[model samples]
Target: MLYLTIDETNTLIREARTDAFHLEVSDDHSAVADETEPMRRVLAGLPPFEAGAYPDSWREWDELVSELTNRGVTMRRVRVVSEPLTDYLRFLHGLTDRNARLGEDIRWLPRHLVDQADYTTDEWWLIDNAEVAFTIFGTDGDFVGAALTEDPTIVDRCVRVRDALWSKATPHAVYSPSGWSG
Candidate 1:
């Protein structure tokens, strides 16, 4: 397990993600709002990922996604959350549309729908069916670091976990965290 600095991690993912046939992310917690300068403003008062706020950063991210998808990488993210969403979920829900628009597929699944034995409580990214980058967070959901590995068995485990949860998850467009009946 190699610990990665955030910048190195981002560059690694940016480069590795392009050659992958599929890239999947499992987000089990509300992401840290203060991780970036732009997100800090959203935490202050701006809407989530509001277009005009962080023009440069937003363009960079958008361009990265475009580049990856143009090269045939299929990116999908599955957020495992309890129903009758939490305040943070509602906050994150606001960004799914923008994420989808950027060419990544997004899904939402109630915690109960996933098999407990096959899922992880932590956030992770399974890339190219051969690598897993597990995100580590501090007690307050602050980003700490990442552990990246390319062991085939570990990657296989993540693949199964992603497949099992994704099979029962709702695609972003049809998912209504605010209006869930559960």
Candidate 2:
């Protein structure tokens, strides 16, 4: 029942010992302004974001992922997106290569392929399989805060969901957004 600010969540992820799993169930996260500028540039027909480019927030994340990977910690993310893609998802798809290159194993899953009843609707991060941090978003799809718990029941469920979805999702390198429209 403990709540964490975004910075605290980032610290938790950075301190993960062996594994960190992120399950992104939403298609839009407009409140995360870190990528706002990059998204704007791309949407306006400009070049996509580069690793060290604008929005220092991304650079911070890139460094964290790189450091975690160097420490042999596995970081994985599964994004469950509905098609045709939302503009935000499309924006994310374009920027995923940087994440992959930085050592995160990112995957894309078509929402239709999943049985929603089996998973929590909220987005979450399973840190080293010992704790779960559920992301709380406002009605407008803006992230508000995170609820972190170490309860075995909830953590176990997240582990199961992560394993099941990871197996079915397509790796970022192989996924194609060709048929989808924003």
Residue-wise lDDT of candidate 2 within 52-101, one digit each (tens)?
Answer: 56566666888999999999999999999888788788889888898999
Cα lDDT over the full model 1: 0.68
Worst 10 residues of 2 by lDDT: 49-58
Clashes of each: 0, 0
How many pairs of residues collide in model 2?
A: 0
lDDT of 1 by residue, 34-106 (tens): 4254444444566655565556645676777777777777877788877667655655676668878878888
lDDT values, one for every candidate: 0.68, 0.86
Q: Give the TM-score of candidate 1.
A: 0.79
* Candidate 1 Cα errors over 4 Å, as ranges: 17-46, 49-51, 55-59, 178-182
